[model samples]
Target: MIALCTPSVWAQIKNSEHPITGYAPVNGLKMYYEIHGAGKPLILLHGSHATAATTFGGILPELKKHYKVIAVEMQGHGHTADINRPISCSAMAEDVSAFIKFLKLEKVDILGYSMGSGVALNLAVRHPDQVGKMVLLSPVYKATGIQPAYWPMLPQITPEVFKGSPVKLAYDSVAPNPKNWPVLVDKLKTLYSQNFDWDQKKIGAIKSPVMVIVGDADMVKPEHAVELFRLFGGGQFGDLQGLPNSELAVLPSTGHVGLLFRTDWLLAMIQPFLNKQTN
Candidate 1:
């Protein structure tokens, strides 16, 4: 299932309404989203550094096969309203949860990538009934298998200080909130330096069906995917350890950003996963 999705490659979302749709979503930002198909609602959350447009690209088309996909771009990214305040995983998660409820959706299949996965976790944990099924792709280190609430507070940095990091330079080129600049850079660095311990006790609280996917080379690493997959099904050291019905998909030679453009393989696997649920 490992295939190349070059940057030049593109996918046109046919049947998409003009300019997509925007709503006065939670967090007081105009969240951007587009709806397609005519079935169970599936919420797609993009990575922090990317917009929904760039992350899903081609997969949205195929997902429409059996799902009414609602791909949403979070605040400070893509077509969503911009904000200058500090950004945190909990802040974004609250915004996402509010949007889902504001829309009056009975339940939704949720898929989150990278930083967005943190938001998804918060949603599933706090509003478990709203989530029918969940998928986390290379979730941030803390959100995947750590105690999301136990995140260690760190010193926030400015973009100038973040510029010293190589990863920051590569991220700033298409930065969604250029206004936040150094604030964002410093925040990400701090977030990465210390991973919240999402232990089995915390994960045991999640009762929804879950699937964890990862590119073998993902920045979060394969071991993380295994831990998440195990947690979703109950971990070896936990009460529900060895719980069934969870799966982990590993795509070799793929990383965080690379997986975003690699829609072919993503659709091939994700389509079947969601299909099994709705059917």
Candidate 2:
């Protein structure tokens, strides 16, 4: 079961005391983003139904100390407000790309969790030039990448299921039109239920270095994560050829929602990878 981290809880624990928050008009939607710290850019994408604060609140202080963290709220999620378009990963990626252009940032690192991981993947694939390095946490590269049991549960995630839940509460608290709760839920259901997968060849063609992080008990299967790692030139015998540009980490005793909350563990893995010089 995914643990809910409400905004109220985040405010208390978030390390970064303050952030420069704003909305960027991109792809017909006012995409909300928060900038923290200074230095190299690091774009953060939150999972489905999660706000930026809820996803990365715990790690903001540490992350910001090393890079300029840009946390974005995708369409229909968090402060971005719902839009008329479909909530597919590709569409969200395009919005992120536009947001990057709007900010005039050249080559930035990106880290995404769950649904956001898919968006980060699409962004790196479609606009390779903009992405420097990537960190995908519990990403779903293909429909089958998700565990079999999770597939059946997707259709059952209707608007009614979210009533009184943290996700709904979070949405109601910040959404411009709180009454449009049903609309956002229904759109997310559509996004979750859709059968979508990126082409493996195209994914393999991506040049930017990547780090694939997954929890042992995550919704995404471990073997599938390994497959994704291999597609990016990882999983080879490192002792013989030296480590590949890509890397993978399967955190023990962790689940999807718990993955982001493990800030120290994530930073330990992520910082080293990001600090490495890219050839």
Candidate 3:
């Protein structure tokens, strides 16, 4: 059955507005990304589990109409998908920074979803000069501490871990496991997820406009998202945009998956915000 995506979403992909492309980040990591329109450059970062295709699939077309959109597939996921992936989220953030430099692009727009948001936040926090505008979709901020549930993903050298194809199996399970929250949490812990601290102070250090968003029914604790918003220094536009210009959009009855996939709802929440950026 064909999915019912918002007309704008479908139009972006259909009208050949956004063209899928790839980039070889450091270590020959062939990262996948897509580009659309020709205005201010915008980079799209997808969340965990699936590839960029899954997260940015709907917003591509619509966004293409406004700014230059670039969707990237982080290592071990999507086009960069591979097992025994050499790095964690922090490393992935570094890879993104390298990609931007290799492209010879000084500054651009960024929209991050779920895990992608974390990666984007890391870049903004660490490499401020690389990004102009930032959007944190269901952002994950470890300001207080790591979630107990993510303990499994913490680094652990298990003899049996590298056995067969641990990486592929890990990616394969992202979908089915998402059905049950607890089970998913357990799986993440087992994956040896790293607990990297996100310094809220660094967020304030970011010299760019920022937007934070989350669905009221989002599964990932909303507080985490709020922490990210507040980290931006929330003054107004141009000042980090932690909480002020960093408007939080929460759709009632929308779960994490719904927020990421709901074309109309996502457009309603993000379109205006994005429009205001670099417009």
Candidate 4:
């Protein structure tokens, strides 16, 4: 189930025709963003070392039909250049908060993949009023949520490791400084090295309803996803107590990157969940 994804397996942002594209000055960084469609705002956050277009391009068309999709490329990723500050979810979350304010948006729905999940979670916990709903795909609440086997590979990751890979190609295609791939990798390495554990109280205290999705064969432990669901008032006998505001999904036979390919399965769950009323 652990296999490398080819370039064809993922969609590129440049291939899609988006109506709005610009760079926003937020938190001392120029963040690249694209806005498509109309109606309620939906923010899309990509995984580590990924661009929003590469991460969500496959589903962007469908997402835009129903939402005012705002896909952003965070610092050191995509068209955004690297700054002297280190990369961390908390800091990125702050950048996003500033972005929302910059856009003059009141509340928006956020869908975050992999590393973006951490940023989404941080935003929900830190600025609950600004987030209406959240979708956390392949989330990690603590360092240990990552499988033990994958831990050994983190310290060894290099820009060269992604050579000739879709990840690298996507980065090379649109990054402001394509040669700075190594710099992005190094910053991400520092982010991964830092000890991170969101307090259980913070997870449980998040008021915004969330949808947690993961692949059964994901690098993140399935048990860890379950634990997060429990914190969201899940793991209950719904037949007796009614459904919780939050939701959980485990796509069968899916790997981490493979989870993005399951677009049909994702929309099937996401559309109804997002449309459902919280009140």
Candidate 5:
């Protein structure tokens, strides 16, 4: 299970709120998003069944300081309304790409956690020209990247399983139609239950640099994280040859959910990588 962090930072972010919020008409659904601060665009995608607030609340304050943070609420999540279409990473990536174009952003950095990470990866692979860099937190690129034990649990995540939980409560608070919670849950269940094994050739062909972050105890196995890093031209012994453009960080004592809560730790690692000048 993902660990929850202290509520102070979350409260602060919610109370202050994003200065700008709007819905971008993309691929039939009006995708909701919030804009904070201003600089190089950095699109943030939340995990399954989560709002941008739920996933990035703790770190948004710091992240916005350096980026024109665009925190997106994917279809059927948060303020975004439900649609008739099925939810999948590839489809969501397309929506995001269109949203970026709608905003006239030439190229932007992308960051995502869990399910959102899948979408971010797809975005980089499918629309390489639209992406500058990528950060994948607690992500699994392929079906086998996830632990075997976790596969069986996907089908078990029904609406009833999330009743009264923070995820449900968050949805109820911000969803355009609060009663559609069950429908959102059902769609997420279907999305998560299906197996996703992206083409390795496509992943290796991504031109943008990437940063892969995972908890040592995350749902995604550590070795899989290393393998993904390697795919991105990272994980090399850089004693003589300089480090690769791609990077990896396995936070100690962190879990899937807890990984997002470590704002200070994440900032320290993420800032330097983002600030570095690309050769």
Candidate 6:
């Protein structure tokens, strides 16, 4: 049985406790993934500059009890080595799509955080039939979805800034080439610095049920989440018009880092949504 742990224990769990781990050859990169428990497939995608263990380690134990949790490390992050290509959310989403097809999973639930949430959104929009239910943590579809103040700092991000942080520590422990840390940072800097945004019409056309969760103080503005909710046909008077296929949740007084630790509250809300049938 996997015991619940904090992100600090990521290296320990990733090294010794992974139940099933393998590499999938997709999009010219050997993507690494870990599988735990048994039930309907639920894919877990980590944020940028993080590994699956760091992003979802706290809730993996609880989630594994109910679903076959498949945690994946995307391009240039964690165990997956970077290719000689630029990093983009759209391309990463396609890599995940190819990974799903590689596994022969017809449909699966997906939960993504931060950068991973953008990949999840791209997957849903690009391959709607392959996704069942989706949960986006601190998601942002457009460049403007993020707070304006954070923009000025994006291009200035460097590997040296996170020298002793958990993100850097986690990467050094598990990444194939720790020396490539600077390269990874550069790729991510370029990816986020772009003025890229998804088309609204495509977002509104997704058929899969969605759950949007955000911290009240998250980098992603609460108003942006509500706007995304409306695109999914939300913002209705639920008392009179019934609930929408999608949900929007704002955690009180939470920040991006602290949002993942509230596993108790997260599972309480997530279980029902994943189990509920959507029309």
Point out the worst 10-residue segment of candidate 1 by lDDT. Answer: 1-10
Clashing pairs in 6: none
Candidate 2 off by > 4 Å:
1-5, 12-17, 192-194
- How much does each candidate deviate from the true structure in C-alpha RMSD? 6.0, 1.9, 7.4, 2.4, 2.0, 3.0
Q: Indicate the residue-level lDDT of 64 in model 4.
A: 86
The prediction achieving the highest lDDT against the true structure is 6
Between candidates 1 and 6, the lDDT winner: 6
Candidate 1 Cα misplacement greater than 4 A, ranges: 1-11, 14-20, 141-187, 190-195, 234-243, 277-279
Tens digit of per-residue lDDT, candidate 1, span 1-279: 111222233223533433345565577787777777768889988775455655665576677677888888776664564576656666777887888887888888898887777778878777787888887787744544433332442343344544534234323433455565554444455444353554555565788777788887766656767877767763455355533655678887887567766677777777767667431
Q: Specify the poorest-scoring 10-residue window by lDDT in model 2.
A: 10-19
lDDT of 3 by residue, 98-152 (tens): 8888778899778887777778878887788898777777776662433454454
What lDDT does each candidate get? Answer: 0.65, 0.84, 0.62, 0.86, 0.84, 0.87
Q: What C-alpha lDDT, on a 0 to 100 scale, does residue 123 get in candidate 4? A: 93
TM-score of decoy 5: 0.94
User: Can you write out model 6's per-residue Cα lDDT over 23-56, one digit (the tens) per residue?
Assistant: 9999899999988888999999888888887788
Cα RMSD for predicted model 3 = 7.4
Against the correct fold, how does model 1 do in TM-score?
Answer: 0.76
Clashes of 6: 0
lDDT of 2 by residue, 34-60 (tens): 888889899999888777767777677
lDDT tens digits by residue: candidate 4, 1-279:
121233444334334553688999998999998888899999999988888766886677788889999999999998899888999999999999999999999999999998899999999999999999899999998888988878778789888888877778878877888999998988887675436788889989998888999999998899999999999888989899888999999999998989999989999999899999874
